[model samples]
Target: MSTLQTSINGADSSVAVIIPSKPNPLTVTYKDLVTECSSFQHKLAAIGITNRSPVSIATVNSYEFIVSFLATSWQRGIAAPLNPAYKQDEFEFYIEDIKSAIVLVPKGAYDTDAPSVKAARKFNAAVAECYWDNVKKEVALDVKDLGQLKGHSKENILQAQPDDVALVLHTSGTTSRPKVVCHRSSQMSVIDVNVNELLC
Candidate 1:
């Protein structure tokens, strides 16, 4: 089972992702989160990121970041998360390296001086300003469909393969030029095994 399914099958009603903007805590169940993810998936389909092409998200800590990331994963897109603190040269190099199709930003966070935004524009990729609050309202997954999708949809859709590069963590070059280290999805198991042995 995918990580998403495991979370949903083991859901708690009181479980929630803390949204800092709201006065009161926004409570969302694992089931609800999955539904929201699916809805966002459909939204992406409507917007045209599918198995053929993928979208990339660029953000600092904002509710949009979580939603967009989940949505992209649900849509079987390659998610390239960039450091929100990257400088102009680093940002430009990373964007070019990943060949990102889109850059998702918060509703009003766009700055001409922002390195990621400028790099995104330079690459001729689309920039989407997502409103987390609005997305929560409009994009919600169907509760009944969740079980079915969880059981089969993930498998039927292309599961990111062992060789598929999940993310690129750019080295923070305090002394020299930044370079990237590609991380493949399958290597996670190896890391987990090694960590378990060390802990034990």
Candidate 2:
């Protein structure tokens, strides 16, 4: 795996991240984040997700959602993050369009009003619920599966490259359907270079 070193709020740290997640209240190290991501990655794989397969993560600003997103990326799977405010019909369309293999719903959000849960049942996608208080235990159960994912080339997990589409933002359907935009990582690099040169 590749290692990345960066500073957060003036503190220098080295991180080996397969997926990215918010810091746990109890854990204070980059390793803790990586471990959490790894655990979620294992769980996804165990449930039969392969690289490039579509998976939807539904949550409301919780650590679980972040971990799930990172875990999907780590496994080289496509992540379709949806608005927690979506209704059943909207969710159905999005999930069907992406052909989501699974929908991850954080605990307390699985009630009838939860669009993800409703759509998951309609689309026959596998639904996995994550409880906030039980995150550690759930993560442990998937650790063994995550081990198999390590040691692979890091490049393989990336869904978008330097010149591929990075995000798919939907627009108003009444005026127009969702529009697709293409973005290149190189464009960011070029912008950075120009700004630095101007400053220098």
Candidate 3:
């Protein structure tokens, strides 16, 4: 199997994502999705996000989250999706456990001094707000604090290897400390293929 990055190709004009909104639902074509993801990936690389860098994403289900998650993986970074509803302590635990290089939150998260932001700051992890700018017509990565990436030179855009860790998830620490799980690039690709096959 191939990596998720390499497998994310399709007919250009085909609908790749849709977000239901109040006034209208947003639709994204494969061309737009791929293009935006690559652009974001470049931004990530510019900020020193390299292979295996843990990128904790604390945004909810939205277009920004999709772009950030996909872009992180495309840049060969480990995407760690966190629940936005998580408490400060929970966020701190996860962020520290993963040694997250950066934490992505919704727009204005910095101004609000969000819990995720606080937790990231506490651990010296970088913090950035990820959001879709209607005027800019693209995803914006507003770096509030470079933290860990401070003084780190720009990183080159890297390709995802089949064995590279693409995603990191955790089990709810109901009884004890949460356990971490790593998913390889090849495994993600295979899962995507299987899901598509089932749909077809």
Candidate 4:
């Protein structure tokens, strides 16, 4: 299995997450998490994200960030997580570096003027939205516009190989520019599983 199946190992009755910071932890099951990932992965593929395509998540620490990263990896694309506190130059560098096909930010005007959104727009990346659906009581992902390359069949999602890049992180870059760290499927799956187990 790849990083996409992180929570599959711990599908038992465990506290999956909490809603916001209200100290109300949500009782999420493994089957439920996998279903969400499957649904979101189809959405990612529908928006033209193919194998090796980069999808940058510019948001705070929340369920949206977790789902987005997993969905991207599930689509056999690269998941590039970014710090929402980045300034203009930092955002520009990362957006350009990854050549992201899409950028998911919090729903509403939160990211309207964000440097990350601006930089992604320069490259014509589809800026999407992630929001908490009160009715469903779940974090949902939405996109205003799909890329031109969209509309491919979602019937067959490409599987990640051991050498395929699943996650891309950047170093603080003291010597020169930020250095990108690429993690393969094997490494990413392990990292995701370990981190998810601890956090969730």
Candidate 5:
């Protein structure tokens, strides 16, 4: 019965994430994680991201990515994560196919005009830079363009339903275009059933 959002509500003081790659390892507790995710979720909903809205994430493994991914699902939106190393063509295919509402890139991506940013712009998908702001002590969402959401009214924060599609990914196709795979919100769980035994 637990959805991704419900499952994430862990002990407040427990460590949830640790990044040791930085000069100093950064640690985040469950309480901080929940607060950060809630803040980001509010930002998404305000921008008209609702159930089934696709939010493409094209950043490296980092705290910003994690927050955006979870927040997207929390808002009942689909989180389509693309490899940061993908080229513009690859990015375009995925972004276009998913019809992403917004694309989240790393800091300064808008200035450098990163491939992901260009692809998003080409598809008229909103583009934003997601990064950890040390000064603000939180993840920053720097929206460059509203794109499809221009003139869109703010949306209420939505709760995820068990049947909602929380994620959409593609299979690597050696022969043709990748196939789209949709993962339901209900699938984000801790249970693993023994199908073979049950069928017996």
Candidate 6:
């Protein structure tokens, strides 16, 4: 794990992330952030998502994006964030290419009529529904039957090795069809450093 994640001290209650959204900006501390990420990681592993498996996250820019991305990383899984504005066919193409284990839609954004949902079903990829936990002020995955899975999960954080895949991004395909580029953990860790600095 990068120092960013491994250094998270749940005992320290200082604020870590402030998510500005409607109604009110949600303020999350280091403890809450770590807790939610670990929870979601187990939920993901229970659903057959393992290291290197791609999980497509289709949502607008929000706190959900940050939490889900970190949670997926915790599980040693590859996160594939796609544009929510993609049409059904566009979503289909990307999902098929990644062989995504599941497609995560935004909280309160689940609808059978939604393009992401429709495409997930067409490709036999599970549709994971998450909701914003107002009380907890974080994004949560729906994993009711995961009691046993979470219980058996190891507490040790899953650190990224130099060669482990972390993220998969696509080119604009300006010259030809879009090409999928796999980013290794070492590379992403470095990028994360700059990203965190900017966010801070």
C-alpha lDDT of all candidate models, in order:
0.53, 0.52, 0.86, 0.69, 0.84, 0.71
lDDT of 2 by residue, 1-200 (tens): 11111111113134322222456343323455556666667766666666566676666655566557556655656667777778888888887877777776666555543777778777777666654555344332212111223443333322323432222334557777664332223332343211112112
Q: Please provide, for model 1 over 99-170, each residue's C-alpha lDDT reduced to its tens digit, 9 standing for 90 to 100.
A: 766666554546444676677777766666656555446432222111111222222333334554544566
List of clashing residue pairs for candidate 6: 1-159
Q: Against the hidden true structure, what lDDT does model 6 obtain?
A: 0.71
TM-score-superior candidate, 5 or 6:
5
Task: State the lDDT of candidate 5 residue by residue for 79-183, as single tens digits.
Answer: 998998899999999999989999999999899999999999999999999999999989988899999988888989887778888878899888998999998
Candidates ranked, most accurate by TM-score first? 3, 5, 4, 6, 1, 2
In order of appearance, the predictions have TM-scores of 0.66, 0.62, 0.93, 0.83, 0.92, 0.80
Q: State the lDDT of candidate 3 residue by residue for 95-125, as single tens digits.
A: 9999999999998889999999999999999
In candidate 3, position 84 carries an lDDT of: 88
Q: Which residue pairs collide in model 3, if any?
A: none
RMSD of each: 8.8, 8.9, 2.8, 3.0, 5.6, 4.5
Residue 168, candidate 3: alpha-carbon lDDT: 91
In the range 1-200, model 4's lDDT, one tens digit per residue, is: 44445425545544444444555654555566666667788777766788888888888777667667777777788988877778767777887898887877777733366676676666777778776666886667677545434564543565556677888989979888888899877776655443354233
Worst 10 residues of 2 by lDDT: 1-10
Q: How accurate locally is residue 118 in candidate 1, as Cα lDDT from 0 to 100?
A: 74
Of the pair 3 and 6, which is ahead by lDDT?
A: 3
| lDDT tens per residue, model 6, 1-200 | 45334545667677867767779777877777788877777767767666776888887766677677777776778889989899999999999999887788865445556898788777777776666778865577763222212344344446545666777899998999899998766666654432333133
Q: How many Å off is the CA of 125 in candidate 4?
A: 1.0
